[model samples]
Target: MTIKEQYVAAKQAYANWGIDVDAALETLKKVPISIHCWQGDDIGGFEVNKSELSGGIDITGNYPGKATTPEELRMDLEKALSLIPGKHRVNLHAIYAETNGEAVERDQLEPKHFENWLNWAKENGLGLDFNPTLFSHEKAADGLTLSHPNEEIREFWINHCIASRKIGEYFGRELGNPCLTNIWIPDGYKDIPSDRLTPRKRLKESLDRIFTAEVDETCNWDAVESKVFGIGSESYVVGSHEFYLGYALKNNKICLVDTGHYHPTETVSNKISSMLLYSDKLALHVSRPVRWDSDHVVILDDELREIALEIVRNDALNQVIIGLDFFDASINRVAAWTIGTRNMIKALLYALLVPNDHLKELQEKGDFTERLALMEEFKTYPFGAIWDYYCEKMNVPVKERWLTLVKEYEHDVLAKR
Candidate 1:
């Protein structure tokens, strides 16, 4: 049967469970996932310094044809977006700012530095999300930023974050969508630190100073991200989950949950409901972690499905900002972006297709047998059929067909680089 015929059969199957396949597709299309730009350039931004990645973050492989210029990066991103279905936003690091061949310090950055990006986003009908580049700089060489002991260094990073917020606000004001500005620092020690409270205290103070200047909430929102541990911070991390959760709650800011930023066994899916209880909204940096914080390309795994289910089941789809965060330079950069994003969307689609209310009612009524059986039955549902229908409707390649476009681009465009 044709794709549409298969979708009709799947829709009829879901209708037996009182689930509307059309409504699920519409809801999935409306949710926007912010695609990270760093995946295309291996986290190497357009800055003139071009220093190696530092501050506990590392990209493992060295695939050829990584975008080296602002124009090239945007072109690659445009290609990746074409293969992925759904409306999406682009997440930008402060280091990606285009300065027109001038040396611009991070603290001295302005919205003008990203005017090119703003124009590009506007043209593409995409919203922009911003991040302060707190790592891979001279000041962050010690693997400490925003919580650095040196007053001068801390002040410098603080100013940079403040400037980043303004730039984010500018993007939101221009694009008519609120920009989420997230702060993630790699401040920790390789070995045990005598005093952990001091760094956190300093971090709090610095964040307070950076937030002192009020920007319109309609334009920009602030978020803090926590890390379990990093490459050089195995012993102790300053911005632990506990620290940022308290800070975000006290300050009424959004807390970002990165899937790869937790312990091997810990999952961010469980934390979504708890975070939604207090905060009006939250952000997510979805990536796959094999055993640790490896930032591998995301796939449609069990944890990913659970994360999507929690967001949908709790009725927090509108309240949570979904974003991709992974840099795998070992494979085709464009293909990596396309694969990870398509998987993210697929997870959400699968969650939307589930009869969440049916399972919830079964559990609440203490019908463990039915609930277990129904859950297992859903595993065999024609989810892929509905996914193909959605992709076809969105005018994107279905299944592995997107790989054809990626291969063509690799030969024609990436090979020239």
Candidate 2:
């Protein structure tokens, strides 16, 4: 049977379960996932003094034809977006700013530094997100940033974050969407630190100073991310989950969660409901971690599906901001973006296709047996047919057809770079 014919069959199957396939597709289309810009250049931004990556963040492998300039990065992103279905946003690091061949300090950044990105995003009909580059800098050499003991270094990082909020606000004002500015610092010690509270206190003070100049929430929203441990911070991290959760609750800011930022066994999916109870909203940096926070390319794994299911089950699509955060240089950069993003969409689509109401009724009635059975049964539903239909509607390649486009672009465009 043809794709549409299969979709019709799947639609009938779902109808028997009281699930509206059409509504699920519509809801999935409306959800916008933010694609990280670092994937194109392997986290090497367009900075004049691009220092070696430090502070617990590192990208492995060296695939050829990585984007070297702001224009090239955007060009690659445009190609990746073409293969992925649905409208999406682009997450940018402050280091990606185009300073027009001039040296620009992180603290001295303004909206004008990203005028090119703003124009590009406007033309593409994409929303923008921002992050302060708190790592891989001269000041961050000690693996400390906002929580640094040096007062001068802490002030410098604080100024950078404050400036990032203004830039985020500018993007939101221009694009008519609220830009999510997230702060994640790799401030911890490789070995044990004697006084952890002192650094955390300094970090809190710095954050307070940064948020003193409040911007309109309509234009830009603030989020603080926490990490259990990082490469050089295995001993202790100041911005643990407990720290940011308290800070977010007290300051009324959004709590950003990175899936790989937690322990190996702990899942961010389980924390959704708990975070929703406290914070007004949540932000997510979705990435796969094999053993540690490796930032591997995301796939449609169990954890990915669970996270998507939680978001949909809680009906928090609007309140939660979802974005991709991974950098794998082992494969084609554009293809990596397309694959990870398509998989993310697939997970959400799978969650949307489930007979959530029916399953809920079973759980409420204490019919655990049927709830378990139905959950397993829904896993084999004809999700691919509906996914193909959605991709067709979105004017993107279905299945593996996107790989062909990426290969062609690599030979014709990226190869030259």
Candidate 3:
């Protein structure tokens, strides 16, 4: 059957469950997933005086044809965006700043260094998000940044985060959208610590100082991310989930959750509803973790669907800031992005096609049998057909056709690099 014919049949099937496939597609189109720029270059941002990847952060797989310059990274991102079915935002780290060959310190980074990025974003009609890079720097060599014992080291990172918020506000003001400036520090002890309270206290004080900076809250929203541990800091991580959760609640900041930041058994999907109850807004870093926090590419797995379901069923689409956070240099960097991002959208589409109200009613009424049967049955429904039709409608390649485009780009543009 033709694409339209398949879509019509699928739409009718969903209609039987009181689902509106067209409406779901429309909603999906409007939702913007913040694509991380670090994926293009494997988290290797263009800094003049760049330090090696530290703070337990590591990127494996030496894929050829990686983006080496800021222009090239932006170009690769544009190429990937062409294949994805919806409009999206670009997430950038502080190290991605363009300083015209000058060794600009992290604390001194300004919006002027990102003029080209702003112009490019304006031309492409994409919103921008910011992150304060705290992992790979000399000041953080001891695997502690804001939580460091020394006053000067903590002060430098505080200034860097404050500067990052200003850049975030600048992007939001120019792009006509609020920018999410998320702060994730890799501060912890490799072994057991004699006193954990002191480091956490220092970290809390640094955060208070950073947020005290005068900036338009409407333009730039602040977020604090917590990690269980990292390569170096395995025994104890200062910015644990409880630490940031309380800080965010008290400071009225967004608590950014990374999928791979928790224990292996713990899931971010299960936490979304609870978090939403306490905070007016939340941010997500959707990543795939295999056993450890490996930062694998996202897939359309059970957890991903549950994550999407929580966002859709709760009507928190606008309240939750969705961002991708995986960097797999083993595969084609562009294709890795295309696969992960497309799967995230696919998961959302699958969730939208669910008979959520009925399922909830079944759970509430204690009708487990029917709920299980229906949920299992819907897994085999005409989800792919609806997705393909949406892709066609959005003017992107349908199904595996996009892979051919990626190969061509690899052969032409990337191969030359």
Per residue, candidate 1 scores C-alpha lDDT tens digits across 1-417 of 999999999999999999999999989989999999999999999898777899888888888889999999999999999999987999999999898889999999999999999999989999999999999998999899999989999999999999999998999999999999999999999999999999999999999999997888899999999999999999999999999999999999999999999999898999999889999999999999988888899999999999999999999999999999999999999999999999999999889888999899999999999999988899789999999999999999998999999999999999998
Best by lDDT: 3
Using lDDT as the yardstick, the better of models 2 and 3 is 3
Whole-model lDDT per candidate: 0.94, 0.93, 0.94
Q: Give the C-alpha miss distance for residue 417 in model 1, angstroms.
A: 0.7
Q: Candidate 2, clashing residue pairs?
A: none
- Note each model's CA RMSD in angstroms: 0.7, 0.8, 0.7
Score every model by TM-score. 0.99, 0.99, 0.99
Predicted candidate 3 versus true structure: per-residue lDDT over 283-379, tens digit per residue: 9999999988899999999999999999999989989999999999889999999999999999999999999999999999999999999999999
Clashing pairs in 3: 56-231
Task: Report the CA-based lDDT of candidate 1 relative to the real structure.
Answer: 0.94
Where is model 3 poorest over a 10-residue stretch in terms of lDDT? 226-235
* Candidate rank order under lDDT: 3, 1, 2
